[model samples]
Target: MRPGELVPIRDDAAPRVVERIALVRAAGAVPLVGDPRWSASHWQQVQDAASRAEPDPQIAWAAVTSGSSGRPRIVLRTAASWSSSFPVIADLLEAGPDDAVALPAPAVSSLTQFSLAHAAEGGPRPLLPRGRALVAQDFAEATVLHGTPQALRALLDAEGSPRLRAALVGGSHLDPALRARAEAAGIRVVAYYGAAELSYVAADHGSGLALLPGVEADVRDGELWVRSAYVAARYLDGPLRRDGEWIASGDRATLRDGRVHLLGRMDDAILSASATIVPEEVEAQLRTLPGVRDAAVVGLPHRTLGALVAAVIEPDPDAAPSLDDLRGAAAAVLAPAHRPRRWFMGPLPRTASGKPARAQIVREIQTGEWVRLV
Candidate 1:
């Protein structure tokens, strides 16, 4: 395939794949681009669009990775390089032919490859045709299931089933309450951690998150750095290669008991005078409070403290609780640094994938839109 080849692509996969194909084309590498959802004529349109664009001789192979929200950036990886991680996922999931799997739409994520491998265990496992119609009935016989945290919650809520032996949760943080429910229902829910840059770095078995074989990770100065076989070639916008190896992730983590516990992003940490405030720690404490359904804690720019903690929370509608009462509940178990000095009610802004939109909310606060009602 030469640059601007009109390959019929399908939207059935994550948007990242399409973006990757585009990046390759932009770099003078040819790609036949078409959305699977589109007809032949539409494919022609895509091809024409690519054909008309001026090509750059030196385009980086790195794909722009999209988080749950925020801007997407390039992360270079060859098809062969990304596929190497799949077999490990296959082994971890123990996917078999008899094992049916239910996947959310845009099923082309790195983790979803586990389901694909499971289906392929037989000659060809039937893919649950793309749609929002995936219900308990859809996967009554499915032994394996995979989805983003929010997607899984919706599936479990609308059709909580007891058939699965294993479930993979990723693309965002998993809520403790959601975990407890899935476990109670006889489903072994595993929290998966990885970025588009590296697929399936670690996953929880029935026991807990264990680093996949051959993947190494370490915490330095409270930030997580990963050296693995799955890393991409280079950033789409920047030069390929840094130092020698290893990408310094924005995530902050702690290495305890031979496992990495993610502690939010290092850039988002609030440096208030002498004390460093971790907003996620405060948010976690708030979520444990009675009547708090969902919560996000962020630092509001402050004149003296440098940054002060501000919490935006969703109260359980059934409880109809007050902020004072919620704070009182948090007081018993939370330290002062973990308490929100300011509180706002209603839904927290989340990414399309449903992680808290901390960056967006922080911007709103800085612009004086997120007013403190309590």
Candidate 2:
């Protein structure tokens, strides 16, 4: 291994991923880590793509985005870009030498891999699972946790991991209802809004995501643009857009009272009857419904309306919510146009990183049979 050399590290084992990433850095090579869980061909596609990527001398890490919608993207950043945030994040998350971060998720995700690297550099010790799925034993020594909303919910449902004092959640929206529940459990939930490409945007310690130090942000045409010393140097495909020092975050948001309110990905907007509906805005309200666990809103094809506002929900197993129930709850919070015209209930497709897979759900709804809720 040499500086600027591309080293392919194929291993999905959580412990090994941490070890290998640290090892690769010491050897001065860019570790292009692939998920061993991926089929050989899929991994090959990633490796082949990386082969053509122009080498960067300062690059220390390379990772593929969780391709939930389309082709996964390869991103690059220097080791210091992440290390620079550790001291601040440690204070924000309340991480200490006594805290052990339990990481039961797959190793390939940006958040997971980042935590591994973070722990190695004295953030917190990472408690990795020895098996494919997390069990009670995985969290025995853990005190603090970082996960997506879905993963956090799973942790709450499962037994053990009792030592958890705080949870640092990201990668998707953390429902206000869910955050309330976590607080009731005596856990300090700190939800942060960020992109894999743009590492740490803003963090919320129960209030709302305010800009972290060293990060500058603004809104233009309803989309968020950020300029920070910590952002990724470039995407493996090409350079990121920069207007002066700021780069478009690709998220629709509003800057109200110095808080960053993420609507959703710019691409997740639903066009129904000439109105633009952000699915996240609706989904957040829907998740507050008593029986709803998670929700995904999409533009379902309709001959008369072009695309109807459709909602696919992962309902609570104990009490499945009806379409009328969701409508009634959403009436006060959401506009009539933003309300879901049609409803569906199912397991709700999700990506590896645990975000709702809108693209896959659209495909399944169009071709496959989902239990439609009336």
Q: Give the runs in model 1 whose Cα sits over 4 Å from its true position.
A: 3-64, 67-71, 108-110, 113-129, 132-138, 160-162, 206-208, 239-241, 269-374
Over the stretch 1-374, how does candidate 2's per-residue lDDT look in tens digits?
77766677776666676688778778888888776655455567677887776666799877776442113468888888888988877887789666799776666666777787788788788887777776767887888887777667767788477888788888655778778888888889988877677889999987889999989899999989998877888877778877888989888999999899987667676655434576776787788778999999888876434478888989899998777877776654555557788789988878999888888888888886765676
lDDT (Cα) of model 1: 0.59
Number of residue pairs clashing in candidate 1, backbone atoms closer than 3 angstroms, sequence gap of 3 or more or interchain: 20
Per-residue lDDT of model 1, residues 260-342, tens digit only: 78776676766432234566666776777788898898777664344677888887999856867977766554444445778
Q: Give each model's whole-structure lDDT.
A: 0.59, 0.77
Give per-residue lDDT, candidate 1, residue 323. Answer: 69
Q: How does residue 280 of candidate 2 score in lDDT? A: 73
